[model samples]
Target: MSQSIHTETSLPIEREVQAAIQGQRALAAYLATRFETQRIQIFDERNEAHQIELPTSALRLLVDILAELADGNAVRVVPVHAELTTQEAADLLNVSRPHLVKLLEAGELPFHRTGKHRRVRFADLMHYKGERDRSSEQALAELARQAQELGMGYE
Candidate 1:
């Protein structure tokens, strides 16, 4: 069975969200420019201290995630081996449940049956998404080329 991925955050006002997004962007930029590994120290209210080290790549990913969250975006972190439900996969692809089912039925995307439900591997879904994006980009480029050739005022 596939597990649900929940990413819910509440920030009612737009101004607060904008401020958070700006702060995240600035922190991300600073982290990107910094060369040294980051060590984080946490102190509890009771004065207990804890320290942890973060690799640069992991820090970069954290920064990106933070920026997305700050921008009021719901982010879900799934392991590469995680299996997602049909609804979750559809949501990730920004398509309807029926459409995603159609793709699965057509073998356009791979999925496994969990009883009556379909479960898609996170890695497989990501691969499909990347391929779809690249295909769209290529098709758009081709259309632009054709438009340019026809003097349709397209750059």
Candidate 2:
């Protein structure tokens, strides 16, 4: 029997949605009612929009539709954290200081101050690691399939 492959795909968020998420409150609720995609769009009063893509059974075309309406605005999801040092977060992610800071500001990983220093939570680090691992596994699987098709399996 042929092996069954399950692939996960995500659509790119528009640029306008990200702005709306930052500027308007009413727009968020309005879009929530109008759109039924697995993901939700964040927006602010300034018409800025951003998107948070959720893995759901929504139609594959929803991403394109949203992009057309969003006008390019899309929100990036940041993880909420409790308390952990910047160095600690970086160590867990195996990245440099500058990159970690960029992630924090880009809304990829959220952090806060406990006394006078920045901190991230253990949970967030692990979650990010898991995401990375999943991607790695997917790539490896694809590579293996290609190798087998070429009449070459592992040595």
Candidate 3:
């Protein structure tokens, strides 16, 4: 069995939606700053209140996720420590299972075998994806530069 865990949450509440729609700009401004707040308070339907404290970095990430949800974007939250099977990792990377297996076999991506199955860490997959994206961007930029130099007039 795979150790990966994925959670999908619904969009913000009505009040939150209204706030996001009306105050998106202000929200963006607030997020741009290094606001220092240690805890967040939640009020229940019974009018009871509770507080949860989090570190500054965690709060920042929470705010970022909330901002994205407020903007009507769906978000997937994956823990850094999660481990995914080959198929799950392949799906996340938008590649074929066979290709991912080949990558694993070639030692391009680090993985550990469980019996006959291979497991890849979510963090490692993300790191490899980032590097791959950066490399692709650089190659595209170089191609554009070459086209410009050759007066290809393809723009």
The most accurate candidate by lDDT is 1
TM-scores of all candidate predictions against the true structure:
0.79, 0.39, 0.74
Q: What is the per-residue lDDT of model 1 for residues 15-124, given as tens digits with 9 covering 90 to 100?
A: 75676677667657657556667776779999999997777677777677667767777566778998999998999999999999999999999999989989999999
> Model 2's lDDT to the true fold?
0.62
| lDDT by candidate, in order shown | 0.83, 0.62, 0.80
| Per-residue lDDT value at 112 in model 2 | 77
Off by over 4 Å in 2: 1-82, 113-117, 151-155
1 against 2, candidate with superior lDDT:
1
Residue 25 lDDT in candidate 2: 42
The residue-level lDDT of candidate 1 at 147 comes to 97
- Model 2, 61-150: lDDT tens digits are 344444444555332323343356888678668899789988888878767777877777878777877888899999999998888888
lDDT of 3 by residue, 1-155 (tens): 65536565676777776666555554444444465646567799998999976566765576676677678766677778889999989998999999999999999999998898899999999999999999999999999999999999957
Candidate 2 lDDT at 67 equals 45
Ranking by lDDT: 1, 3, 2
Cα error, candidate 2, residue 67 (Å): 50
